[model samples]
Target chain A: MTTSIHTLDTPVAVVDVARMNRNIQRMQQRADSLGVRLRPHVKTTKCAQVVEAQIQAGAQGVTVSTLKEAQAFFTQGVTDILYAVAMAPNKLAHALDLRRAGCALIIVTDSVAGARAIVEFGRAHDERFEVFIEIDSDHHRSGVRSDDPLLGDIAKMIHEGGAVLKGVMTHAGESYKLNTLEALQEIAELERSECVKAAEAIRAAGIPCPEVSVGSTPTALSAVHLEGVTELRAGVYVFFDLVMHNVGVCALDDLALSVLTTVIGHQPDKGWIITDSGWMAMSRDRGTQAQQCDFGYGLVCDSNGTLIDGLLLRSANQEHGVASFEEGMSVDVEKLYPIGTQLRVLPNHACATGAQYPAYEALQPNGEMAHWSRVNGW
Target chain B: MTTSIHTLDTPVAVVDVARMNRNIQRMQQRADSLGVRLRPHVKTTKCAQVVEAQIQAGAQGVTVSTLKEAQAFFTQGVTDILYAVAMAPNKLAHALDLRRAGCALIIVTDSVAGARAIVEFGRAHDERFEVFIEIDSDHHRSGVRSDDPLLGDIAKMIHEGGAVLKGVMTHAGESYKLNTLEALQEIAELERSECVKAAEAIRAAGIPCPEVSVGSTPTALSAVHLEGVTELRAGVYVFFDLVMHNVGVCALDDLALSVLTTVIGHQPDKGWIITDSGWMAMSRDRGTQAQQCDFGYGLVCDSNGTLIDGLLLRSANQEHGVASFEEGMSVDVEKLYPIGTQLRVLPNHACATGAQYPAYEALQPNGEMAHWSRVNGW
Candidate 1:
């Protein structure tokens, strides 16, 4: 007999397949409507089945955060992979290995020194690498400024040093802080424009810059247009979380990932329902903490995926999540959620939560469950 | 030619073997002097090699937060195991399986309902399972109050139903908030006396309560005496982190764990030296945020493991960490920390950071490295 989600062990990662498919379709349609290639970042799920589904639903290529991800995806027959993070000289050999093994692996750099290292490594190995110069959009994190002269110099370093200057890419990660569509649209425009400007500067400097990629979950869903962008990339949309919910990108029902936990005990005087799933299962990502509605840990839901009103996973230890009622709703917690009672918790950030588990219990609409293995660690 | 710490891939967990050995010896000596058995919680570093060292250093039994840890340690010949987390009835079968395999797996429960389920499951399986009654020493997390009448009833339920009533246990997890020796000792004594009171209550009810266990990293180190406590348990002391440092327990040099990362790029305008280790590598555990000094994500250290004064990992994305000067200290960003420069980051919480990697590169005193595989996922 096949095991259902209810039969699986507690503190396990569960993926609602129906909701996941709907989310996948929504983002694919959004990217299609915006007229750009959708290269979903596999760093979010890192699951072969999920990536295969995205590819089947029209994701052009995959974006990875590590060489391990690139190697894993490449081994799974995915040839087009972009190692999104700036290439450290130490990892050049590993990236070269993936490329030599017939994978179209692209590397990224935002500094002249980084570009020089990639070029020197490629020259030493007799391999010309496809490289992308990262542009700093909204000053969120890594990347060269769009108007900075370093951008053209880095682009030239790659092209002139016998490496392919593939394009310019930037993630509007700051968009995660916005709660309104107007703000998200404004940042999305900024991300697209800045990245495109960098690409144009590279071209003006006699380097061939083909692609302009930009996205983040909120921006990918809220952007009015993608004028100069060639590809849209987003990760958390596949498993929309409470952070995305508070960001006005998706509703609570759109969340596909939840930690399946069992109520192991209770703290009656404090109105706490202690759960088996804690930071170890849901992750320590308080991504929703600074958002409009801070979900302390996560939003509580019933075993069948129904939201439990006023219930929240307030605090967590390593293996124990202390869930309690929000402020004044004082019901007999033990009578309501007793020992052995199974509950589901919607995570604040899907990518972080997913990384905690080795596999996902994909709950199908027909009550069947499939085990989907995820690639964790660097 | 042996592999050195510098040769390991970026964003890898590195364990200073010498520091770890010193930590192990210190905790073992503390337990010895306090006249209590040391049951070091293997949840901090779930590596068999680390656990082996702890056992060799005089730790009697292992304390685990998950049944997976028990199974793993048991497979490695550690039969004396205490599954410290409150027992969930759904996991009774797994516990039974371990017992049937000749493993002395001790389980815990804090409620009558939980006791009844454990006894019933044991009766059905023809096994008298050893159990410990969890006591709420400081209103920290899960447990029955020490003076609560329900405690005796739960202990009596297990004894009357033909299950082995092992003893009483408590963890003064709130001790983590204490920075002064007096505060730590007070909480530690409170933990000891309260857990002993619960054991006395159980015995007063005619149930042979044998064991009295209590601990926390801070309490374990600061307790002048463990008076009525038979055994002590602590986890993070094995690989002390920034939170423990801020709590005034371990010195900066006592930190046995650090995430070895490479400087990938830089945001010179913001004086941010970007590294490959982010929340994904160091974990989103801002455990030190509420402590004496908030070490943003972690304290920055040089490649040789010496603290770099005033430099901190200020913010983190999924795969990128922004390391910047704390306040007044300023240096030429590009000139000081160039691309490809390796840096070691001390995590805010060792348990959380250690969980991010599947294996650790143990840095030997002789400048060699050994791979220690960690068991992750429940």
Candidate 2:
């Protein structure tokens, strides 16, 4: 049931559906066993077809990074969505629209100004929107300090404004920067504790808090205990990338998505094999900058999905990818992959690479191909 | 004439139409003065509107990174399109589709297999496709060596395959690696010499060679002489990015496209300003990896398009951008930019960043906004 190249176009993003289902089931099982709800983040695929698979795998709700995603998924019949980013006033109308459309919309905010903006917007619209106060767990990225006076003030303001203060949410985003799984687990525990503390502060301030959310692919996958986290929101787990593998979050084999390309030329003298898939196809996501190993842009795979022994897309231009084999690794670039030979490249960041193309050519376990379009932009 | 936020969404890509028009005119003037055909590469924007603008500014033909781009522009009445990439068999049909639809299509190949594949596809389909033998210049990314023995053999084969061997093409992509304009000029000269030599070899082998092409934004913009280049193909000049500025191809003021985002929150004590524009909005293109100065992700701008002093997006998550103001350069984040305040962010690589979104919100010089969609995928 393998689709012929003639029917499909080159440099189109293709996802192995069988592999993706397996990946989703595995993550769902892990969350179920841990007594935690898995809220699969839709930011990775931005495809309704993929989100349907996640929902089928027992995902409690979905997390989105943009209002456009919430609007798209809400239209597609998936109502519960957590807009994982801080809600801005300009985007309030879109959020309110989703809320009015029967979506259990949850928006995150960290500052007093943010809380006020949401309150003002919610008041004007006469909408009671669910709100999550973002807590700074490791001081890695954006968040309100867990014990900061601002956190209590924001929670109190949200409660007074008639909006439901769901609880606190924090992401151990810097867990990806850890060198070991132990470090990731430690970061996870810290994130959980910080979130719990933020929730407790809001409660102590006479505000009702329902859930404490904490997430990061590395931390969630490695965390020993989900002490306070009622829901986990991790996106990259569905299509593990090189950065995930480098951080000990997943193995290279766990990567379900790949960029299928064709070798178009070669510089035998320089040991470079040129491919039609360049940065435009594979994406410019060099996720190895903070990792232990740099596999150039990505791991090169044969047409059959087997990792090539030494080949690497070391450099790329707009429309040209240059493959460099390891110093003495034996791989016949000239014969093994002729000019028309098809190959797949596992990307450094699946989400970034996936977003570059418009649609995905889904491949089933039986090798059947189905075209699925991905939604983009806000 | 200013359009309200409700008219166009925040965190949307905006291209200053007036600046882009000026950029097109300037580049066309440079090419006209140099007495060379300007085949402006459409890879930067991938928008037919931008391509139409380029053509209107005197671009004789256009260069495309993918067959999909060629198809889109051709459908928009752009007849002459150079598929400025090594042509693979998988994409031959789509390239032929463009040709059959009355497009003056030209593709490039460097390997015997590439030449033979294009020839075989042409023969099987009974179609003719123009081709240029891609020559490896200073950039070792792709293409056959200028003096490879297979060069002459491949050229002869392409000429006899019912397809015209236009000549040769080379790109000094490494010109972006230069630190000074003088170095870029040297790389430009080297690129021109390589293309000329490849064409000379094909001519010496008794093949009809009519065109020699060479291009790279840095090379095309800095080259003082164009001795052998019949056509110049350069992208990224229309919307200069951080990479272009670092490479001395353009200045900071030359950047025409930017992501318009809203400041959603602030971590005042930490000097962190959070914006709705994250990697998903700004793209994960850190093109300054090779440059001495790392502007984090990109330069930050006020709502009025003025570059913020010493403030840069220091870190980014999937949907969150964290800006850090250099020590001693402090501005009240909340005061200057409240929760609803709009800001613009100049991207690292315009092409990669621009591709994340579906369309451009074209901003006129006087601040009016119009929408234009960009084509994606192959």
TM-score of chain B of each: 0.99, 0.97
What are the clashing pairs of model 2?
A: none
Q: Would you estimate the TM-scores of all the predictions?
A: 0.99, 0.97
Off by over 4 Å in 1: none
Candidate 1, residues A1-378, lDDT tens digits: the string is 269778899899999989999999999999999999999998989999999999999999999988888888899999999899999999998988889999999999999999999999999999999999999999889999989988878988899999999999999888988998888889988998898898888888877899998989888988888998899999999999999999999999999999999999998888999999889998999998898899999999999999999999999999999999988887899999999999999999999999998999999878789999988877
Candidate 1 A-chain TM?
0.99
lDDT of 2 at A329: 73
TM-score, cand. 1? 0.99
DockQ for the candidates, in order:
0.89, 0.80
What is each predicted model's overall lDDT from 0 to 1?
0.92, 0.84
- Give the per-residue lDDT of model 1 (tens digit) for B1-378: 389777888899999999999999999999999999999999999999999999999999899988988999999999999999999999999999999998999999999999999999999889999999999999999999988989988988999999999999999999988899999989988999899888888788788999998888999999877777899999999999999998999999999999999999998878999999989999999998988799999999999998898999999998999999966777888899999999999999999999999999998888788899998988
Q: After superposition, how far is residue B199 of candidate 1 from its true place, in Å?
A: 1.4
Off by over 4 Å in 2: A1-7, B1-7
